[model samples]
Target: MPHLVLLYTPDLETDADIPSLCRALADTMLEQRDQAGKAVFPTGGTRVLAYPAAHCAVADGKGPYGFLYANLRMGSGRSEQVHKAVGDSLLQVLKRHLDALLQQRPIGITVQIDESQAQVYDAKHSSLHPLFNRPA
Candidate 1:
């Protein structure tokens, strides 16, 4: 299970095409492969969501600066290398997508990956996965 959530200031909404970013991130997740060349994230299990904070304050609360924070959560089974690779790829995409906006405004972008530990409780109920599992 891999879910990417993006939280950003409402001020950036006009310049940030969040829906487009979500599509890009979801596509990137589906492209990741393990060492065996198997998909790192199931096609039907990948999710990218973005939410704009209705009210917030940037650093020092003195400027028109904005911020975007990306957090990716996934089950723990992959090696550190895989995690790093995935994080790097995502950061690159985010940076590339916001390059133009960054040049025009003062904004902070952060990306982080979180892995659920073995002992953590997890549950899932979905009819979507079966659609992707159909026989080819």
Candidate 2:
């Protein structure tokens, strides 16, 4: 499972085109492959969600400064190289997506991937996975 949660300043919502970013990110996740060339994240388990903060205060509470924080959480098993590759790919997309808004205003973007350890109790119940399991 790989879920990307984006938290951004409310002011950027109008110009952020967040829905597009979510689609791009989901596609990027589906594109990731392991050393064996198998999909790293299940198509049905991939999710990208964005939430605009109701109230945000930029540095010194000065001019309008926007911020986008992306956190990707996935089940652990991949190698360090795979993790880095995934993170890099995501960061590049995030930067490219917000480049235009960055030039127009002061915005900070941060992207990070978190691997859920074995100790973490996780549970899932969904019919979506079967849809992706059908023969091509």
Candidate 3:
């Protein structure tokens, strides 16, 4: 099975606690599984990891999106549809917690799905990380 890793910029919480975020991601992935007939790439049996960004701040922009940066990876190349789906799912979760986070800061989300076939050195990894060393 292919592995996917997700990374989000800016710490999830003011205090830097991501328990709730992680739980929500896990739930979202599982929920999408049965909601759709086919499995959702990356999100399907995918694992998420979130951490506090060393540099966390919202950019001056106009929109309902925040200046957030997210990264996603899959063994297969990422498609526009896939990015939209994953981004939508993540936006939903962020919206749910918008009250506590800067939800409308023109979030800069970047998702990169792998194109090369599965490799032997490709070990499974999580998306969330401290900052620089997260998913691709």
Candidate 4:
């Protein structure tokens, strides 16, 4: 179970880039696995999921802005450093990608990590997810 969940608003240009970002995240997980000696994934590899139903509040009464939600899961073995590293890597990549998409438009990016060992909850209901789902 990848403990990290990286969320972001969809790029104004294209939302298809999310899959590529997910791939990069998976690569990072593998690198981290090699360095940390703990499987980032309990199974063969990490499970990366994407959501196209993101809504961010917009300026007028118009509504939420378009966004893409990328959920990448890698078993972290409950390591705090791993959690931090995951956030760091995801943010770095997301920042670069979002910057290109924003094109100087006002935007915000955020990453959330779940380190709890009890159980994995739905990302929709997850506290971390909503925090990043703020108005634009």
Q: Pick the lDDT winner.
A: 2
Alpha-carbon deviation at 107 in model 1, angstroms:
1.1
Candidate 4: Cα lDDT at 40: 52
For candidate 4, lDDT tens digit of each residue in 4-85?
4445444443643777776776666656653547655533334566544365454453533444334444433656776677
Per-model RMSD to reference? 1.2, 1.1, 8.9, 11.0
Query: What is the lDDT for 123 in model 3?
Result: 56
**lDDT score of residue 126 within candidate 3:** 49
Model 1: per-residue lDDT, tens digit, 50-106? 999988988898877989999999988898878988999999998899999889878
**What TM-score does prediction 3 earn?**
0.51
Return the candidate ranking by TM-score, descending.
2, 1, 4, 3
Candidate 2 clashing pairs, residues 3+ apart or interchain? none
Instruction: Please give the range of 10 consecutive residues that has the lowest summed lDDT in model 3.
Output: 61-70
Poorly placed runs, candidate 1 (over 4 Å): 118-120
Q: Candidate 3: give the clashing pairs.
A: 6-127, 49-128, 65-105, 65-106, 66-105, 66-106, 66-107, 67-105, 67-107, 68-107
Model 3 alpha-carbon miss at residue 66, Å: 8.3
- Candidate 3 lDDT at 5 equals 45
lDDT of each: 0.90, 0.91, 0.51, 0.55
Please report, as a residue range, the 10-residue window in candidate 1 with the lowest summed lDDT. Answer: 115-124
The pairs that clash in candidate 1 are: none
What TM-score would every model get versus the actual structure?
0.94, 0.95, 0.51, 0.60
Residue-level error in angstroms, candidate 2, position 28 = 0.6
